[model samples]
Target: MPDLDPPKRSRWTLWLVLLVCAAPVVASYFSFYVLDLRGRAYGDLIQPTRDLPASLALTDLKGAPVAAVSLHGQWLLTYVPDRACDEGCERMLFMQRQLREMLGKDRDRLDKLVLVPDDVNLTPAQIDALTAHGAPATVLRAPRAAIEGWLMAAPGHRMGEHLFLVDPMGRWMLRTPATPEPSAVKKDLERLMRANAGWDKPGR
Candidate 1:
């Protein structure tokens, strides 16, 4: 009987093929998650990844239609709530303002955005209150369905309980913990700005 053994050359070829197929994916993860990384990210990464739904559309407070794509190219700090401002909504607004202010010179690269779910209107008084608070937030009227697609409730939580972060590249990159401590969230934002320093600049 002839002795049988796996061919050395075939084993080498199989290993080479596996390495080639995996190299790009490995390199990309390294570049994004490890290489020269600087951000103090607070949100845990979802393994499968979640993103902003493309189908969702929103209108500004003025009724001007805006696409989710409009948020691209800026670090967006977003809050979702009904049009009628409540105490919780007020707190979110305040936190957003504080987070932006904490950025100091890098603040301009960030946008404070509020997405109002449903057709509920913002009364003049409500608008004035937000303005009076010195919060330069852009309030948009979004369909409830669209809003829900992006902002989710934790297992037993509600949408507005947490603040979400979007990167300059338009990815819903982070979700600060529910009722995150402002100081901690500020540090996370600052670290993100620092990490992307080479790419992101202060502007519209």
Candidate 2:
């Protein structure tokens, strides 16, 4: 009589493979939501996150329609300012560039979005500053009222004072303080990137 045992070896192999594939997703979830960091996010994580509106329309400085690439498929470091582009506005622009550059090899995974209120103008110098961040540095004209509803500012502050982090899924995930501390903001960015390593990659 031939031995008549179950195919335990094949069953074990299948289970092993499934575990390996699921490990990353489990780990990512734990790191992002379950793990208890000393003080939550370095930048205040927006409680009850908001989604980027699909119907909201934005145009470039010349009044041309903006591209979809700016709003989706990559993490966004966003700033909104009045047309004047004052000293504070210029500083925030520089901060956005600096923070993205600080991401180093992961920099390409991020995009900078400057929402131009219809009342505001994008000066030549401002345009030059944006160009320095490389391709797809988005500067677009959008309805101030509409955009404000999505990205909330720090209490007692205007929208321009804050820098926002939009997840690849088009959600407003985090908002840095009115006066950003680069080190603090960078900590928040690095943590998210590390946690999302399982699903997120350098490009898009």
- Could you estimate the TM-score for every candidate? 0.74, 0.81
lDDT of 2: 0.79
> What tens-digit string does per-residue lDDT give for candidate 1 at 58-97?
7776778888777777878988764466777678877888
Residue 5 accuracy (lDDT) in model 2: 52
User: What ranges in model 1 sit over 4 Å off?
Assistant: 1-32, 35-40, 46-49, 82-84, 119-121, 131-135
Cα lDDT, all candidates: 0.71, 0.79
Q: State, as a TM-score between 0 and 1, how close model 2 is to the true structure.
A: 0.81
Stretches of candidate 2 off by over 4 Å are 1-30, 36-38, 67-70, 132-136
Instruction: State the lDDT of candidate 2 residue by residue for 75-150, as single tens digits.
Output: 8899999548899998998899889989888888898888888877777877877866346477788888878778
In candidate 1 the C-alpha lDDT for residue 140 amounts to: 74
Query: Backbone collision count in every prediction?
Result: 0, 2
